[model samples]
Target: MTGDVWAVGDAYEVYVGRWSRRVAPLFVGWLGVGAGRRWLDAGCGTGALTSAILAAGPADVVGVDPSRGFLRSALDTARVAGDAAALPLRDGVFDAVVSGLALNFVPDPARAVAEFARVAAPGAVVAAYVWDYAGGMQMMRHFWDVAADPEHDESRRFPICQEGPLREAWAAAGLTEVATRSIEIPTVFASFDDYWTPFLGGQGAAPAYLATLSDDRRRRIREDLRARLPAGEGGEIALTARAWAVRGHKTAG
Candidate 1:
């Protein structure tokens, strides 16, 4: 998930957005957002987390992403096409700021966290969640483990997605009460093809990496994943995805 493809913002609703629903409530719940408060969903891809915030009864919500197409899809709230490191809104206006599955993709997560702290009022909450790329993000782990293709590296893409780095980014940004937890969600596939077909769409890192391979190589990779995945009697494969989530509050003035 580079800055380039994320700029397009199409089909991700079905690919990333669909799967991210599993952890949306968990992240928003950890946020503990209440009603009648303004919220900012930074890097709110396709309104997944934004929708969750709305459901939790926030008075207003604003979603910002670099992708215009994603902003278009995120029709439930105020939308802005912009970068996370630099939001074009006034400072100290929001009651809470949150992002989901986004920090790892941002050009500068530390800067983004500082920005989240910047736009938040004193004592307002700042929270975000990212997939555990090195560990329990099963789909990605499986793909990277089996693919072994040097054309792309997931670690380079998600340097701050783990527990330690996530907490460090928040603390370095001067946020207080910095705390983190792991949120696990189910990733159920109707069949192996249900899970395998999306990788051909060329949206995320796996798909993008697969795009660079020859047709035969891609087919082989697919077959290898099919073999490695454990299927149930009904041909369904159930996997758990774990995302590391962090939350903190801006210091009171």
Candidate 2:
């Protein structure tokens, strides 16, 4: 198994952070939590969702992630080095507990969702979003389709990214009013180089796999992607990314 590498914050920003930022506001807005509520951004890689929560006038927001390197790039907010499955925070302390684009990467997503519930106050919203890798996340779907390796495909590796699994996880964690939706955003690359260069950064699944390939094989894959991706006359490649977002409320005590 080719493990995903996420140490380089700059590389991750280019690869997926930009798109995750686009999804953050939408996910936050969907929650519709009122101003002045405390928020906990579990698995808050580089603070994409944490920044969005801040923009919503929260009383306070704390971001927790295992990546210290990524934390350095996060916005000025309360941050802690922690894992999603086992957050280093007091229980029932937050009005909103959220994770974005990070749930699928967790080794045990059910445990993480339980932690989300544990940290959330009664009636608090516990929500998360993950890239729809199997179908709607075109950026990754294109890569895996061209890469032509089912073993390396994230869709196969992370079945919990889908709607059914997400809702089930939330419900099993004892959350109520569990619901799921798709958040789609435009991913327009300035050119083929813009799209291809990020894959060479080796920050995520596809790039990690690419790093294991021989130079000649890498060139072949790059050329294949260049030929396959739809480019306009202006040399812009427009694609879309979709994330399945799940939201639920901790039962009021």
TM-scores, each model vs. reference: 0.95, 0.98
40-108, model 1: which lDDT tens digit per residue?
999887888877777777469888898776777676668888889999999999999999988877878
Worst 10 residues of 1 by lDDT: 1-10
lDDT of 2 at 121: 98
Q: Pick the candidate with the highest lDDT.
A: 2
Q: Look at candidate 1 and tell me the lDDT of residue 167.
A: 90
Q: Cα lDDT of all candidates, in order?
A: 0.83, 0.93
**What does candidate 2's lDDT look like per residue over 1-253, in tens digits?**
9999878889999999999999999999999999999999998988889888888775599999999989998988899999999999999999999999889999999999999999999999999999999989998999999989999999999999999999999999999999999999999999999999999999988899999999998998899999999999999999999999999999998
Query: What local lDDT score does residue 94 receive in model 1, on the 0 to 100 scale?
Result: 93
- Provide the lowest-lDDT 10-residue window in model 2: 50-59
